[model samples]
Target chain A: GDSVTQTEGLVTLTKGLPVMLNCTYQTTYSPFLFWYVQHLNEAPKLLLKSSTDNKRTEHQGFYATLHKSSSSFHLQKSSVQLSDSALYFCALSELGSFNKLTFGAGTRLAVCP
Target chain B: GGIITQTPKFLIGQEGQKLTLKCQQNFNHDTMYWYRQDSGKGLRLIYYSITENDLQKGDLSEGYDASREKKSSFSLTVTSAQKNEMAVFLCASSISQFSNERLFFGHGTKLSVL
Candidate 1:
């Protein structure tokens, strides 16, 4: 079985501050890690994803590197903005089971002025 | 460039009642999925269809039934609603069942059982 863990349930940051959302995973095989973002009343959308270990993937000012040894794919941004407030989910899928995804209890990020 | 559409943005049901949620995807994807999202619990798979006429149970399929009548549509039914059950149901689609494909999700259906 595969599972994802998001350590922080809520993260509040001032505008222009850096933020990191912790994500760790457990899987039996090589895993595909992903970050999805959801704004109020909107569907979740893919923010970034990576399967290559140690390779950093960036999108929309967010970046994550898959660290197989550490079993982590933490999402980070250098500076937070007011519009960056949203729910962030970390998910994982085994190498062969692409249709199934295990998501972490999302982190609610609030960026304040 | 395609979208997944879920019918009835909000649903209110009585305890023990049967409720159905519908999903349609214009992505022409080969796989469709139903996931339940509870507060602080994230998304859990309810059911998935690899192709038309196919149905596979997921982690939380105990109280639900699913049907994939065509490639573009998939439906889930709550056999017997439970009192105090409230969650959002999300419908998603992927181009294939490959581990590398990205999933596209629709605006979820919020269900409340009274």
Candidate 2:
């Protein structure tokens, strides 16, 4: 079985501030970690993903590194904007379990002016 | 690019009623999945199909049944609705057999049972 944990339930930040959303996972097999973002009134979309440990993956000004030893993949961004307000979900798919993703309770990011 | 379509963006049902949700994908993907998202909660796996006629129960499958009648379609049925139960059901598809394959999701069907 696989499970993911997102520590924050909600985060509020001023525009241009740095952002970080914590994510951690547990699995019996190898891990494939991912970040999914949902804009207001829209379906969740993939933001970034990686299975390679210790390697940072970035997209759309956000980045995350898969740390196998710590079982963490924390999402971060250097500067936040109003457009970055959304719900973020951290997920993991076990190596042998094809197409099954275990997701964390999402974190709601509110970027304020 | 492929599309995953989920019918009836919103669903309302009475308690104990049976409800069905449909999903179709044009990706010709080998795997399709159904996940439930409660308000402010994590997405929970309810069912999945590896290919045509193949069904698998996920962690939250107790009250649900699923079918893959064809390669492009997968459907989920709620055996009996619960009052005050409301959630969003999402349909996703991926091209590969590996679980790590990036999944494409539909807009999701919001369900409310009274």
Candidate 3:
């Protein structure tokens, strides 16, 4: 019973534009993917993590790719700033259930300059 | 390289009041967490502790109440408090409970129920 699907609640962009923040997940085992970033009030960090399926993990400049046959991990950015706005979460880590996390339903990245 | 202290950044309760939220960590972590941030319903896990005293009941533990005795503290209690409720209470730490290990947050505690 692990689930995470972010369909973007809001994502207004401008400033350089090239952004994608859609993530999907649902696990029974062996799946660890994360991307958390919450600014404005601050407290959610760690903006990139993967389990190495398609391999493409990055940080700061943002990037993600853990396609495990389409379970998806999507979170990309080629250019977009204005602090990149914030509030983007997509998490799921339930293999042995220790680092317990399963979140999604957050995608408010408004970066309009 | 360590910090996670959440203590009353802002809180004001009234409806049946019984609120408490405190957490501290110096990174000597084993495990400690209490998350509940709503506004799109992103993070939700109400309790966790894996070392000194150990207690776990995440998935938004019902009315909520937790304590960890030692291991750098971890407390959360809100027995009753609901009426115009607002939420934001996060405190985390990890160096165990491994699945990849990466959680170190604490910059929240904005609860208001009046």
Candidate 4:
């Protein structure tokens, strides 16, 4: 069985501050990691993803590096904004299993001005 | 460039009633999925289809039925709605064979069982 764990249940930060959401996964095959963000009243959308360990993948000012050694793919942002307030979900899939996605309990991020 | 549309943005049904949610994707993806999201909880997979006429049961498939009649449409039916059941059902699609491909989600159908 594959699983993903996100330790943070809620993350609050001021505008312009850094952001980091921890994510870790367990799987029997090669791992593919992903980040999905859901805004208020909106469907979740992809933020970033990567399968190659040690390589940092980024999109829309958000970045995540998949570290297989630690079985982690932590999402980070240099600066946070009010628009970034949303629920972030960390997901994972086995190397060849694209239909099966294991997602962590999301972290809700609130950016205060 | 593509969109996933889920019908009946909100549904209210009585206990033991049969309710159906429909999802249509224009992405031309080979795989479509149904996920359930409860308040303050994570998304749980209910069902997925790898292609037209192919169905796969996910971690939480009991009491649910799914159909992939065409590549662009996928439907989920609740065999028996439970009392006090309230959750959002999300429909998503993605290109098959891409290990890390992102999933495109629809607006989601919020369900309430009385």
Better of 3 and 4 by TM-score: 4
Query: Which pairs of residues clash in candidate 3, taking residues 3 or more apart in a chain or in different chains?
Result: none
| Model 3, span A1-113: residue lDDT tens | 88898987999989898999999998879998889898888889888888889989888888999988889999999998999798989888965568898889789999998
Local error of candidate 4 at residue B70 (angstroms): 1.6
Among the numbered candidates, top TM-score falls to: 1
Residue B105 in model 2: lDDT: 91
Candidate 4 interface RMSD after superposing interface residues: 1.6
TM-score of structure candidate 2: 0.97
Positional deviation of residue B40's Cα in model 4 after best superposition, in angstroms: 3.4
As for TM-score, the candidate ahead, 1 or 4, is: 1
lDDT value for model 1: 0.95
lDDT for position B46 in model 4: 99
- Candidate with top lDDT is 1
Judging by lDDT, tell me the better candidate of 2 and 3: 2
Worst 10 residues of 3 chain B by lDDT: B93-102
Stretch of 10 with least lDDT, candidate 1 chain B: B94-103
Best by DockQ: 1
